[model samples]
Target: MSAAAVPAPLPLSYDDVVKNLEDLPSLPAVVMELLNSIDQEDVDISVLAKKVSNDQALTAKTLRLANSSLYGLQIKVTTIQQAITYLGFQTTRNLITAAAVTGCFAEGRCRGFDHRAFWRHSIATAACAKVLARQMRFNQDYAFTAGLLHDIGRLVLVASFPERYEQALAYRAEHDCFMLDAERAVLGIDHVEAGMALAEHWNFSDTMRLAIGGHHDPEKPGAGFLAAIIHVADAVVHALDLAQAPDGLVPPVSPVAWNALGLDEAVYLQLFRETELQYEEITMALLS
Candidate 1:
């Protein structure tokens, strides 16, 4: 028997999608507070630690992650302050955001999305981005956070339109096409827009918004450097089949991004090696 052809995807209301994003669920108060604190002219660690400390569960998780093998700390961290000191202000902020975002999707309602595998891929990509940033002498902490939330829009889509997104996933699986194509074909909008909308709603930095929105297609003139890093890191992860559902298409690396980074083969090999070595520990620490 011949294979059955897939039908066209249903059209979506672009306005409603934007509205849905406008009303997307707000992050926990502490997370929001922390996010705001990092943006201030002068961030006080004591105050930041107090904010985290107020949330007992988050404090504990933060401390545990600080002491986890992923960080390779010599002395155990018993409090949020110690964690802040050891992990550095930006790193601590990244950890808190990672915890908060992971908790946001704790109860995954998306039918086809594998939450655990999805996170595994995210953390691994984060690790890859961080290592790459350090090797290239960029801001490692920011790179890590950007990598972690690179696919936030996909999660948002799954959360808002579970059934439709599931069909999109199914279509991608059947045809072996990229998720971006599948989503655009099925849902009339892709995660990039969804994620960018969410980022804007959340008051994320312009750079972060750019990274989330342009990681897949950084072709526009004057694309953000961080977005370019995320673009390459995302492709590397997919190429290695690190995610639960890696994108079917490994989009070509942007010449502008590649030439700008000026990374050699040795760096790429080292990134893969470091990502492999730290993937499990970092994933465990963050996801546990």
Candidate 2:
């Protein structure tokens, strides 16, 4: 049957969907606590380290990532404090967030979704965004974070509504259509909405939430600078086939988004090379 012939997903209220997702994997307590304490002036490295250290496994994972070649630390970090110090507050916070978020959905649950490949695409998009941000003279850190989480709502849907999500996946496969389109047709709401819901629950910054919500449709009103970066970054990642699902069709770049960056083809070639290099290194460091 043509995917177009597939019946649209029954309308599910956003609140009901959120409630159904309560059983999905959640961010670690330490990560949540750290997020809560992010704004305190005195939430020193020691306090953060102690919280992470409380979870021995999480600390070990964090330390492993800290020492990985991705960070390029000259000296090895032996403790959570040392890792935090070496990586700095903001980078450390981002690392914690990445680890916590990635760890939650590492195990592939929903059929038809390529869990590892999806994360690879996500990391590649983040790498692309960071590189693009550098070329455009924007905040690389924020770009990377937003790029990494841009498609998180898809994960939320797959994890929370496995059976229904599977049906959406089937539609995409049968029709050879974009996953976002399949999701919208089958779920009545796309990953962007689902991701925004989860982002709100997690208290993500407004900038980050906007990026997630507006990544696919950057031309939407109120879409910020970061949203445009991620929008382009996602397209670039797809162009290179860095990481993606089986039917991960590359979407076209928005002219508005492209014009906002003011980058030329030469910059894109550089980004492609950099994304390939960073994607391999970071994926090994974090997932290996």
Tell me, by lDDT, which candidate is best.
2
Candidate No. with top TM-score: 2
Model 1 lDDT, full chain set:
0.79
Model 1 agreement with the true structure over 1-288: per-residue lDDT tens digits: 988999865677656567786455677786776776766877667876787788776776677667766678999988878887887877787788887787676455877788887788788888888888887788888888899999888888888889999999998998888888899888998888888778877778777888887788776765688888898888788777766564546667878777778889988998898887778777767677
User: Residue 251 deviation, candidate 2, in Å?
Assistant: 0.8
Clashes of each: 0, 0
- Per-residue lDDT of 152-203 in model 2, one digit per residue for the tens? 9989888888888888999898999998889878878789889999998887
Candidate 2 off by > 4 Å: 1-9
| TM-scores of the candidates in the order shown | 0.90, 0.91
The alpha-carbon deviation from the true structure for residue 84 of candidate 1, after best TM-score superposition, in angstroms, is 1.7
Each model's lDDT: 0.79, 0.82
